[model samples]
Target: MPTSDAVLDPAVAARLTRDAAGLVAAVVQQHDTGEVLMLGWMDDEALRRTLTEGRVTFWSRSRQEYWRKGDTSGHAQFVRSVALDCDGDALLVRVEQVGAACHTGDRTCFEAGDLGAVVGAGA
Candidate 1:
């Protein structure tokens, strides 16, 4: 159920499937390049803000508050588009990134060396 302060569209909210914590995983990407940037979490309020405010907003699980990207870091993400995954439990936020997307000043959060895995053979 949406909170008392909910402002999300009813039709859109009805399609969501929030976790026990009322959050959906939001995967952010570079709008034009399609580079995967980072993942954030969002509750209904955060999603609503991101959709309407032209900036990416996230629900901070650690801080237990709402945070707008690039507010303090100056690495703002301007929302270009947002899409809910088929399951309605995840979100894809395409943005015009201003600076590093990761908190560590990296371009992407997946910058750590990849774990060795068997290469897949395409059909």
Candidate 2:
């Protein structure tokens, strides 16, 4: 569960109050390995489920369903820590991953090579 200090932060609380969408982006990462696993979205229930279950669960925007990160793929993620960005509209979930995090069987979703060298040194 998030500390009271985090959940009670005025900035965080403010962003949590979405317009009519009831959604927020969640960026998932591996805690120990420092690898990005995946990105998903969350609603109030999804947030509660992740905190309560200590697992990485997301609300599927396309399917309109709740997805438990390794439920079918056998790549479950155990929560280690969670943070809200300064704007409080997004979340960073640090987790302990069990297996391949990406559905495509890649270690990370961000597998593209750096193009900074070609993009004027840094884009």
Candidate 3:
């Protein structure tokens, strides 16, 4: 994996724990409704862009490039806030989602992924 020399706040970078590919998992959510929108990966530079530019940017693992949300789809995610997980291996990106978060035009990626697991008796 190529290292990023892009500028990111030292303090924020220090808290990150990336994977072997030098990427962190980002969980995108609707700021107002708390609905999980989608999942994306981010390198330091992508994270910096998301934080500084007020838009969500992700490092595409397959395409091996950076893509800003809504650039082509017009389904943008306007950033509200971001929080690093306790383990520093993940991030929660809160945004004002404009349209479908899924490439399939679904509201969320998880919307159609229910496995029908047996419900456990729990409070």
Candidate 4:
């Protein structure tokens, strides 16, 4: 049997604890590098799309719509694997990031120059 999202039952989605906006936390990470790319939220449909479409999709809270990473920016993230946190309230998605993952064109959304400088200074 081919293991595809189409055939994979989504019954687990109902067990997730969503935020007040009906979104579950989704953390995107690079599969090989283990670099955290970005954090997004997903509703049931968004989760379904991400699994079935093979792309990291998120539900935009402000826009109230579904946005697939790299759709317009050409920085698509292909899902390699998905894992549910122990609490079942969060999702970690390992992906193959193509191009910049951040909307600002940075490799990652997290930029802590001060933290890096502080850590390096002590070393």
- Clash count list over all predictions: 0, 0, 0, 0
Q: Write the per-residue lDDT of candidate 4 for residues 1-123, one digit (tens) a residue.
A: 112245324577756887787778999999999999989998777887788889988888788778899989999999999888988789999999999988888998896344544345554
Can you rank all candidates by TM-score, best first?
Answer: 1, 3, 4, 2
After superposition, the stretches of candidate 1 with alpha carbons farther than 4 Å from their true spots are 1-6
Instruction: Rate residue 108 of model 1 by lDDT.
Output: 96
Worst lDDT 10-window in candidate 4: 1-10
lDDT of each: 0.94, 0.78, 0.94, 0.84
TM-score of 1: 0.94
lDDT of prediction 2: 0.78
TM-score of each: 0.94, 0.77, 0.93, 0.83
The runs of at least 3 residues in candidate 2 whose Cα sits more than 4 Å from the true structure, single-residue gaps closed, are 1-20, 112-123
Tell me the tens digit of each residue's lDDT in model 3 across 6-119.
788999999999999889999999999999999999999999999999999999999999999999999999999999999999999999998899999999999886799999
Name the lDDT of candidate 1: 0.94
Q: 19-46 in candidate 1: lDDT tens per residue?
A: 9999999999999999999999999999
Of the two candidates 2 and 4, the one with more favorable lDDT, higher being better, is 4
Kindly state the number of residue pairs that clash in model 2. Answer: 0
Worst 10 residues of 3 by lDDT: 1-10
C-alpha displacement of 44 in model 3, angstroms? 0.1
